[model samples]
Target chain A: MTDKPATPRRRGAARTEELLQVTLDLAVEVGYAGLSIEAVARRAGVGKHTIYRRWSSMAELLLDALSRAWTSDLDYRDTGDVRADLREQFLRSAPALSSPPIGPVYRAVIAEAQSDAALRATLHERFLVTVEQRTLERITLAQSTGELVDGVDLEFAAEVLCGTLYYRALLTDRPIDEAAVDGLLEMFMAAYGAAG
Target chain B: MTDKPATPRRRGAARTEELLQVTLDLAVEVGYAGLSIEAVARRAGVGKHTIYRRWSSMAELLLDALSRAWTSDLDYRDTGDVRADLREQFLRSAPALSSPPIGPVYRAVIAEAQSDAALRATLHERFLVTVEQRTLERITLAQSTGELVDGVDLEFAAEVLCGTLYYRALLTDRPIDEAAVDGLLEMFMAAYGAAG
Candidate 1:
């Protein structure tokens, strides 16, 4: 009994992964809003009910795809200097949101999530909150070390930093290069920190 | 000859507006990427040739729709204070980007444009550049009169400002309220203005 159950469970998990991979492919090739479970099944050569059994709806399936797109090891290394630390973390994560598999998925969700509260909840819960918390930690460290200014709203600052990145990545075709990142940090530091 | 041409010209113009209106409606209801020329023609009750005759592609149709979504008369009143002038301009344009007819359409295009070059081009050309130019004009006015720092990169500063709004309007469902606008202006003034 245990052998039979385990083998099928493994097969199911493999199929789920395939479905997700195909979902990301379609999201990049077609678009987030343009493709559906039917389309995904058609592409992946699976029955539509396969996705429905695992995920509640198309949005949930996409959310699952997006959440898996990033490495959960997004822990920022704590350098002695706050600016360098933040920049390092940014460099690490930038590619995930800008590349084909993940970036397009993220862009699709952000585009759809704007109007759909459920999708936004999924984004905030599964993804964005972690980034926000990390930034807050960095800001707090900077404040204690006399890098950041006193009395700045740490939450708002973190939100703005993430918002600015999302603004560039999803909204504009502007290149989010090192120079642009430096400029963003400059504005952020000037507004939130005092130069030592 | 002029009179004969004018009748069909007026009819063509009216039909074009109707098509744009229908495009916006579909964009808001069905979203940007998913809806096609066939869909638009179906909703607008016209032959597919009608759309093909005027616009080469669905991207071009959505571009035409987005282009007309804004009130071209978004003139900022020349208030003596730069902050006040900028704030007033934000107030004027906030509604169009936040509500239905235009807001959803803008959101849909922004979401879809992330992966499509032609759509991004249309967006950059029609919407973003105008906002950037206006913000640059404000920043320059403030700089020449000694309100802002002398060496600030006027273009970048403008881009950041517009980026922040697009961040809020498209990425997050955060209320782009008066208080939020005030905070953005505060950051802009502090970073760019000569407060030291």
Candidate 2:
């Protein structure tokens, strides 16, 4: 490990990852309300001035940290069947949402979004738009392949599936197990019908 | 209007309604964070003892007041068609939810529920259970009557539809208008299909 010296670019990326990890850890322990620039700096063992230089405010820092944490790419594999692709996505992602760190962070962000207009706006622009747009695009692929009907509303279907998942996670505090993934997919297929 | 004397039961109910109305108005004016039992009593022109007698705490008072404002009960009219019936129910409730007063109150309650176990328990018992059960029952009726498939997941579908409308109302501050209701229903019908 001591054989080679690291480049500045590699060092910068490493430092960024460290800051994000600290942010996530602190967010879990004390929640969004307890989060602040000073605390994040102290937690990361970095100066408050450095944190401010990287991000304008705590909200900005937290948003960046969260956006980076999410596996930023959608896995819209054309399983040759549209419904099957959606089922795969849900199965993969639902568990992450149900897990400890992600679940708590998601809930805290949602609670904060209720009252924080600026945070809500950033949430819509960064997190929500990507999910909604990607889901629609995947649904559109199904429609073009004649897997779905000509006039089906993809946005509405996407929202029903994704929005329902978020609602259940926040509202019920129940774990989204394999059974729920199966049931949700089945219901979606039942409503949308199977691809030929 | 002043010609007839009010009956005892009618008079009691009227006074209760007046108290709830005043509470709602104060909530709108001050907000959840600023609301106080004394303020509510003063605004309602009722004794503080009377307010405390009716509700054990501020959370209970808020719940009762908001409950009075909700008109979520469905008519369950046999339209002889499940799709039409579902669409009508979804559309009929959308505008009221999209209204400024109702939407904010919903957000306030949900935010309060996160930290207050008492509020959480009451919300689940009073609101969530009723929503889930009634929607499931309605969908079950459709399934039995051959309007939907027997394998359709009633619980998931009910949650999906309600959750979608609710997420839109609470998060976006956008109107869940007739168009959105139509979009949601179209997707639901497409997924459920015409078979029983």
Candidate 3:
């Protein structure tokens, strides 16, 4: 009649997710350097052991939080319009990278990674490289369907587009707003998009 | 004829140049946050007053060092070869932003500027915006002379090219080396190069 007991795996996963959210939140409040394991545990109402058991160091915890924060699992439309699809894809990730909570946490992590090699490796592998791969795949798909031009340099186009947005997100006061996105989309489209 | 007595203005200018070189060296040795006016004065064999007189704070000192470090008053060739000129322009700045002393100093300032607002604004104004303006001017010149195609987004092209390099310099282990520069030059040329 009643609900079944939760599995150990489910309990462990739920706790981990809760801890990640806590870390991400703390990243905003205290930033990267001040975000200690002890502080995260206190904020999450979990024992220190709960977090340490999952992450051996604050660096590892920061990387996990960053992976989640920068993740962009976009549901891009095939409106047969490369420009619109590109805009949609960019907007999907821009909010995660520019809005509060996640954005500040990401900025703190990026700033920290400048001096931390192991952390930079994790960021390069998990976020920068991963995002580039996903974007390249989308560009390749666009090419196959004739949305993008044939024989275009896939890596160059993808990196430049994403790099532009990351430029603004990390360094500039200008957010990649709708207008900026449109400009980016148009620039990229002129470079790679198929003609009408 | 006896040499004219060294005017105070000439003596002060020489001392300022020596101080800037000292600070740039300290940036390589101790990094941005660790650099101090005292150390710069000690290394340059000048009084701390020499540096403090020029820059009121370490942040201002850092910006001055960065501006001098990155500036390249290149006499670019209009050799009717886009790739060659592109390579030359990129290589000119790459050494400054990638080599010892200046390169490390620039990296240190960039890392320091990430969390520092006043420093960031100084960097954004003195180096980033200035460099972009010069680059945009060159692109405009190319367009006018029929090197690059007409109606290409000049700002977008310039920013993407430089932004790609900045991304590597600030965030990753990969240096903006020859091959990387080649890829970038090709990308820009493909999108905007005027046909023969």
Candidate with best lDDT: 1
2 or 3: which has the higher TM-score?
3
Please give the ranking of all candidate structures by DockQ, highest first, separated by commas: 3, 2, 1
Question: Over 4 Å off in model 2, which ranges?
Answer: A1-5, A45-57, A67-99, A129-155, A173-180, B1-11, B45-57, B72-98, B128-155, B172-179, B193-196
Winner on lDDT (2 vs 3): 3
Candidate 1 residue spans exceeding 4 A from truth: A1-73, B1-56, B72-74
Lowest-scoring 10 consecutive residues by lDDT in candidate 2 chain B?
B69-78
A1-196 per-residue lDDT for model 3 (tens digits): 3688788999999989888888887888788878899999999998899898988888778778777766644445677666777788888778876567676667677777766667777677656776777778778888999988898688867777777778766666566789777776766776677878
Q: What TM-score against the true fold does each predicted structure earn?
A: 0.74, 0.76, 0.84
- Candidate 3, residues B1-196: lDDT per residue as tens digits? 4798789999999888777777777788788777887888788888888788888887677767667766654345567665687678877776666667666666566666666666767777666777777778777888988888897678867777777777766655666778778877777776688877
lDDT for each residue of candidate 2 in A94-182, tens digit (9 for 90 to 100) = 66654667656766676777777677666666666667777889888878877776776778777777777666656655556677667
Segments in model 3 whose C-alpha atoms lie over 4 Å from true places: A1-3, A37-57, A70-78, A88-99, A173-180, B37-56, B70-78, B95-99, B173-179
Second chain of candidate 1: TM-score?
Answer: 0.74
- Please report the candidate that would top TM-score against the real structure: 3
What CAPRI grade goes to candidate 2? acceptable
Query: What's the residue-level lDDT of B157 in candidate 1?
Result: 71
C-alpha RMSD over true interface residues, model 2: 2.3
